[model samples]
Target: MNKKLSPAALTIATVVIGTLGLASVPAAATRPGRAAAVHVAAHFDLASGQTPENGVLEPDGSLDVTFSVARQVARVDPDGGTHILATMPLPADGGANTPILHFAPTMGIVRADDGTLYFLYATGTADLTGVWRLRPRQTPERIAALPADGLPNGMALDRRTGKLYIADSVLGTVWTVPVTGGTPTAWTSAPELAYSAIAGANGLKIHNNALWVSDTDDGTILRIPLLPGNRPGQLQVRATGLTSVDDFTFTGRGDEILAALNHPNTIVRIRPDGHRTTVLNAADGLQNPTSIEVRGTTVYVLNAAYVTAEDPNVLVAGLRDLR
Candidate 1:
């Protein structure tokens, strides 16, 4: 933890976790090829931290990153602003006593295409749900089971065919594990399932080979067709009247799918022929917008707000959409 922000912990985290600001638009108030008026840099760093789990570009974009602090994972220092290098602990994997590192954390801070840095954890605390791997430090590797009620949201690892797409969100199911290292297979979303399926299945990206899913209670954004014994059974419902499809990114230019449309705060871009665009609305200044990370033109939104004592949603990363 980066510590040093005590104003009573910054007024109990700005009156109980609330940090949402980023509605830039003034590179000169646009006009020329349009894309400027979006001004975002007004001080709300709130110590710069929260549940942002996936943002990379260390190859040399100068920085440009974003990640969860833990309980999933966190990292983002991509130059421009938001600086939070690293903070990890907890995540012993299905063995339990999690101590609580990265539970239900899909794509929990990835970097695998062989560059290897894939660290995901799943241990719903007790019942039994584990999928762990932390190689940079060398002592945490448990990839298996992970079905204690299963709420593991969005995980991806198809570096062409390494296969590891998990998104069980309370059983709507979509599991696949085959880093070539053993067993851990369960992919069910077939015949019929996913009707107001509750549980909150955030996001999962696997473009091309197709695996994109987001069913935060059917706000829609699904597509499953990953063969090999198959069974991820037919779920093709791409984009609907989304009002709660929080977190999605391909805006890296693979073409279309920007989605970070939480509640009212927006950031939808979806395309691939279906075409849809909003860029950013909620009048521009997002509030509950949680988790989003695009590198190119810069789009990092994580407007958070959750407060509860004995264990609640607990996400406190305000916003920062610089697009």
Candidate 2:
């Protein structure tokens, strides 16, 4: 959830941005030898204040994004046009305060094979906070309600089982609910998943027969072995030293992972051998990049530009030849 910026939070964020010198340098400057062929698939002007947090690439190649500040979900066409899909309705009692920041509405989103979209959003009310589904030409329907303290974020689906996995940034817990609609149960929880001062479990992915999750505050990516019967086995650290990691996806090779590291404003490729490579950075025109999705050999990055008060853009880079 993108919390409403309070005076103190704004001041702190400003200090952090200034300390990093991020406010002074433009995003277009390329780091020598680190440049990848990048293009702006879509650009959202600052006037719109559309802080796109997370998104999924659709079957037809369009990208669907969650505008945190705008409280709406929109589809970004292949040519970069944006079409609003749904505006979240406010809760009857005025949604409950978000866990920490109390910022914006939608957080995590995923699309099923049949064009059904499932998203996790803040309703400002405990009872209303949960997963909601939207099928084409159909009204939005609430499917599950998480605990009052749950601040749900990244999501993944097990296509074979028809189960959806959700990550709670605040409580450091992962919950699973059937796509057909049912109660959500805690799939797993640990000290590593809980939020410290910043955030906890942010992005989730099921790859290579295991569940991979990034612990933002702890700067670690954990791989939990998925056993039979939808049970989770041991939790092992796959990679570390990733500060403020957000959404991530498996590369075409399947042996490596691409992640959006928000704080340092870079996208990194983590190999199974624990080697990390900088694929793109602030120099490559990334601004507080929040999530990443790959279609074939093309990589799409959503830049929230959260630190800067202006001009957030989406960047697309081709990796077919590079790979």
Candidate 3:
């Protein structure tokens, strides 16, 4: 489940943000043989106070982002023009004293080849929390509901099978929901999938015919083989000792992975042989980055900037050929 800050904690956070400002380390000097080049594609103005969490790349080169605080989705074009795509509904049970900040429609989003969008969001009520589908020129439709305590965070799609995989940080479980709106079933359950102190089983992807998941609280990445019927086999640890791994994407090389280490404010490249390298760090101007998407040779990152609550930006970089 998402951790709620106490009044005292919120006050402390505000104090810290006020004191530190939004200072970030400068990008490292480029080297002749480096495998990647990092730079900010767009900087979100703090005046807007948009706290974006996750995003997916559209075929037209625009990026669709989810704003957790604003409870809306917007499309950021290649040139940084943001157009609102949809505004999520407010929770039905929002009471007079309820903090609107606590309602996060969904932290995870995915797009199908047909341009349909799917997300996992919560409305602070059992009836409003679940997987939802949003097609162009249509209203958002609820596809499936999670358990009362389930908080959906990361998602993965099996394109070939039209099955969507949802990761619930609160319950530490993954569910398989049909793309066409049907019942969702538990696809896997293990100690590794359960939340520890904070979050677990975040950021999922279908790569090389297997399921790759990030165990955020445990600081590890796990791989589960996909069987003939889209069933998951035993879980295997792929990488470990990561720092607050949230969402990740496969690089051009099928064996390598790029992940957002949220707490450390860095992006890491996990090699096929299990070694890891910091591709981009705070010096590259990343702040609480939550999701990563690589389209062609361009890599896009969503910086949530949750700590300082300032300058939340979408960063872009170029990936050197890994082949």
- Best TM-score among the predictions, by candidate number: 2
TM-score of each: 0.30, 0.89, 0.86
* Comparison by TM-score, 1 against 2, better one: 2
For each candidate, what is the lDDT? 0.50, 0.79, 0.75
| lDDT of candidate model 3 versus the reference | 0.75
| C-alpha lDDT of residue 41 in model 2 | 74
Task: Give the per-residue lDDT of model 1 (tens digit) for 1-323.
Answer: 12344222233234322322333211112223323444333223333334343444455542222333333343333334544333345445522332222233333345664444544454455433455554544544565666664556566777777777766655666677876544667666543324243334557777766777777666667777766664454668777767656557776556577776654556777776656777665344444455565565665555432211111111112223323
Candidate 1 vs candidate 3: the lDDT winner is 3
Which window of 10 residues has the lowest lDDT sum in candidate 2? 1-10
lDDT of 3 by residue, 1-323 (tens): 12344332243245334443534333333435532466677776443435567798898999888775566677899998888777777666541122222444456888999888888775556676788888976777888887756667888889989999988776788899889977889999768977765577888898987988998878888999989987888899999988778898988787699989876778889997789988787767776788999988888989876664445788888877322
Per-residue error at 14 for model 1, in Å?
25
Q: Which stretches of candidate 3 lie over 4 Å from their true place?
A: 1-36, 45-49, 95-101, 321-323
The alpha-carbon lDDT assigned to residue 20 of candidate 2 equals 45
lDDT digits (tens) for residues 1-323 of candidate 2? 12354342354356446544555434457556544577677887444546788999888889998876566788999998998898887656444366664543687999999999998887556666789898988878889888766688899988888999999988899999999988998999978888876678989888888888988888888998889999988999988989778888888786588989987888999888889988788877787788999888888999876675444678888865333
TM-score, ranked from best to worst: 2, 3, 1
After the best TM-score superposition of candidate 3, give how far the Cα of residue 180 lies from its true spot, in angstroms. Answer: 0.9
How many times do residue backbones clash in model 2?
11
For model 2, what is the C-alpha lDDT against the true structure? 0.79
Candidate 2 regions exceeding 4 Å error are 1-27, 30-36, 92-96, 320-323
